[model samples]
Target: MHPRLIAPGALAAASVLLAIPASAASVSPGAPGIGDPYYPAYGNGGYDVSHYDLRLKYQPATDALEGTATILARTTQDLSRFDLDFLLDVDEVRVNGARAAFAASGEHELEITPRTPLAQGTAVTVVVRYHGIPSSKQAYGFTSWHRTPDGGVGANEPEAAWWWFPGNDHPRDKATFDVSVQVPDGTQALSNGTLQSTVSRLGWTRYSWRSDKPQATYLATLAVGRFDLTTGTTESGIPVVNAYSKDLGAQAGAARASIERTGEIADWLSGYFGPYPFNALGGYVPNTTTGYALETQTRPYYSPRQFANGSNTSVVVHELAHQWYGDLVSVAGWKDIWINEGFARYAQWLWSEHEGEGTAQELADYAYASRPADDPFWTVRPGDPGPENQFHIAVYDRGALALQALRNEIGDDAFFTVLKGWPQRYAHGNATVADFRGYAEEVSGASLGTLFDTWLFQPSKPTASAARTVSLVPAEAAPARPRSWQRIAATNGVHEH
Candidate 1:
């Protein structure tokens, strides 16, 4: 899941008092669009993000920074102009190494047009640079942190990225990213992908990380603080590295155990689905005020504040599941969010099955029976409802229930076949509910129109009874042994054959 946009439950409370900021006020450090943010210049087949290479030099001494980005993008069709979402403080813009005209600086997004029309599939290279002291209170395009006595602004929530480079702002447009940050000596910088390399420059250290896969813009993240690295491997042979604050104590045992469990979960899922889909795998536990975690490509950003006694260890599992479900097999749009969230939620339940906590069907039945039918979980449409609704339990839980329904109707073997085949068919691509239905029907050789129509298209739960019946083989009756959960368990005590 992406980090919360605001404090939990705060958005709803603030919604009633909502009024646009007087200007793009500095809501927090690194938030360039506080007053105004950049929007992307999209083409007909939707804004296509090709690649982003950001070069930034951070100077904590003066609390200032300078950076430039070389963004390469192409369109599905010819277009005269478009918009790009970048952080404020940009001083110049160039296209193909030539100075390009751009407007709306100090605003949230940048509007840029090439001197000549850009044809479909033609790549456009853009570059921009600027210098400024990022606010410590808010987060924006680029997050700047000063060496504080305790640490940097860990709790401060304006996610800074715009302050560092120019590109799309929203998660709707997914693309590859390469980030290079140069900071003063002794301080280490971390970003989303597997670390490509690190070198020390004159009085500064440059670190570069590359994600060779498509990623949501907001899911791109970086953490700069004194840090130490601990590395290990999963049972399935994937590299698992943990990055923690250098000043903090070492928890290698805990980290290794938790990460290895992620592999175990993935392996169990592979039996039902396919292999986990990503280049590398691991996490970075940065000190933060938030209690949530993020699925940032090969690695996820985890906040230590969120877990206690490892009881809530499933957060990492949930995010790890996202790599296969959400990151690799993405939803075509927000409306098809089930493909992203619902599958991941089921992955958690699948993990529970592996742990012997409960059977998959039992858990699904529990979630479905507990939640209301008219709940917003069923009402989610593809739109920017808000971050609060992004990982809504309803979406994850109820969505999982929908999958369980299919399993019940089709049976385990067929359902697992669809689960394993989905990522292989649409790896690194987008999918819709219709695509899922078609694929499932095609694979299972069964008609699922009614299943999809009632579960996905219908606004409310269907009134259909369980037409399929379940019977224990050989038809033997046993005396009720327990007092709860099942009515039969509380009644008779002897078995009759």
Candidate 2:
């Protein structure tokens, strides 16, 4: 989740029967967390979700949402009780078609005890009925549910899913999604994947969106409003659908210009990171004050502020790069945010290079030379920047600096190999920082432990000049070249994220 706070974006199991023996069935409550170091209480255990069929009805006037989530999953261990990370008011819960006792626990856990214990490796279907005004609920001090001028939007990094639907909330439990949103007939609804149908009946229009690729719960978004929708195909034949709020007064033209480039940018990114990953491609701009843009699966969310000046494809590149670094190959833990933000922010530099505005090395040199050794910017470790600094500017810039240093150390051929090969190696899967280090080391055949430590792990600037050379300065002096890209990111972009 970029929490530029940009997004939340996520696994698979055997289909054949592999049930636990009767003697091994020791029913117990599933663990409350999936063991993420930064977000220990985030996702739950006991079950691995495969798909979520969310049928929802939303009212813009009341800002109320009523949904029935039909979840298909498998118990990873014998479980008498399981939890779906949620904050909505649950009306009823049924496990395997049997009514189950459910209750609210802690800040975001919807605790449920099925009528019968589930054996390990056994498939189960769960249905949850819930209704609430999402904006009215608050957990961990903030709400991701956003009430817009036209309708409602559920898009944020790290914690948006809690207020909308019930499920395994962390990126580790990836699942396919069928999000069908019903709104007033005149209004439009948008979500991830290809739109299957738009049926109007009884004064309401139901829009059905399906994501065949395994997606994290946070990447599942719901946008209901009056929108001017555009559909097209990229040069490579990838279907593209972009949405713009009908009421984006001053920002309309610029937002449209930037968002229309979704397919083009995705195509450009493919050259360095392989093919576009998802079946669908697009983005949306809702008139909201939320200062960040998020890579919400296929359709990334863009704040109007992102384009206040004009078309800003750099921010678009950052989020779309997430389609690879953050969306396709998710971070195993929130602490490993460098894999997401660093790589994505680096994409902006690459975009600058692609446009002939500036080469990546020039930007890297500028970043390395500009920041003082004593600045707090150097202290925020990119690899393990704790909960508070997960989205810190250092994680993005310094993280990219780390990559540039690696590219210099390993040479362009091997660096590009590691860059393009990483997403393929861990596609649709979760991985940690250690996993990335190993992959790069394997590809370049160089010891990366100290390099990574100095660049990402240490709380101080790098002392070794083993890679590319840069002239350090004490002042915030502009480098001899490439200051435009920095303005694009630092001026309006970094604050939002």
Candidate 3:
């Protein structure tokens, strides 16, 4: 089940003063799970995070990372204790600057019990000191954190932020971040947002980064390595700071050339999607450690292989577009992933159309006609695809196809309105599929239930008529279709003329 926002009345009812006599002094613990069906044990209830200040040091030789995380949050209900999704050996825990008892339990829950029961609407501060090898569990066929040859990359997507620091590790809870990491002198530590300052001392350096914009936990990143740093500004004046691995050697030149276009792409996307969402624009730690590139808030992480040739601008466009679709307006849960992947994929198609390669209509037609009726891609619904299929091709390809179908149903004006209005309305917050559908209907002034049902929910392939072109033809002039056997045989070995 999707987690619903807590009601004010319900929250008040949970408070100790309301539920029990004042003299009794009884308090209830916060719920461990936030009610997400896919990952029930992901986030905690009874509190909302406002900001996270993480200070850490890393040693590549021994693979050891020690950190102190200070989280400022507001209590939603009276609580004896609360939980944070943490997966490290904690040395000490403090609440509101006072010593608090804590224990690590069950997967990633760090159960912290304050010395005094916290009152509802009170502000609380939690500080945790922990140390160990930073590691991530495998989920959706990829590890969130990878150990690079020189250092390591933290790419906590889905529910892996706990591997590095404790927090309410879910997309629903977005918070600003101040992450500072100290590493070896020669190496550079990169993270989201603007580089506040860099200080060197005693063979070590500390790099401080500040992301004032509210960000989800999954989009938080920390990469440490020896990098060739490039700093500039986009045509629109957004700051651009990209870091390339020195290990690329000769390939570093081509990588830098491709990265230099970060400004150009941001300018183009801004024209279509309204103003850029964040204060910074750049890619970070481009290396081959991770097979795929991830939109890590202000600074995305790219794999060297993705941009090996100068011709791989589509992947760059895809990740940069995610800054608006995924990072700015995040999903409510894992089920709404298509809102992110679909928009990014559609941006690729739009870039292709803008470059005169092929129109989005042509791409949608090709994808619709290429897949067989029984293909699993069609069977798995993109809106609620399970955890295993969260990142499936259907999420990217079929999801884009659905958006194109909606665009064809509504004209370009209304479609463009949605593209710009979506992130603008829900910037720095979480949105669900229902929320999107209602917003689209409001903007387009059309009931899109049938179109959404056919494209997003139906298991079978939709008819070509679903994606009607802007210029319509007479019913009698419709194109004829091939027989089912012909399509099946073509999918198999035989092809019939």
Best model per lDDT? 2
Lowest-sum lDDT 10-residue window in model 1: 488-497
Better of 1 and 2 by TM-score: 2
lDDT of 1 by residue, 69-126 (tens): 7888765455555566554576888867777677764444566666655565667787
Q: What's the TM-score of each model vs. the native? A: 0.75, 0.92, 0.88
> lDDT per residue, candidate 2, 289-313, as tens digits?
8888888999999888887888788
RMSD of each: 14.8, 10.6, 9.2
Better of 2 and 3 by lDDT: 2
Q: Pick the candidate with the highest TM-score.
A: 2
lDDT of 1 at 203: 83
Which clashing pairs does model 3 show? none
**What would the per-residue lDDT of candidate 3 be over residues 190-291, giving only the tens digit for each residue?**
999999999999999999999999999889998888898889988778999999988975557666776678889888988778899889889865454445
Candidate 2 residue 264 C-alpha distance from true site, Å: 0.9
- The CA lDDT of each predicted structure is 0.60, 0.88, 0.80
Q: After superposition, how far is residue 109 of candidate 3 from its true place, in Å?
A: 1.5
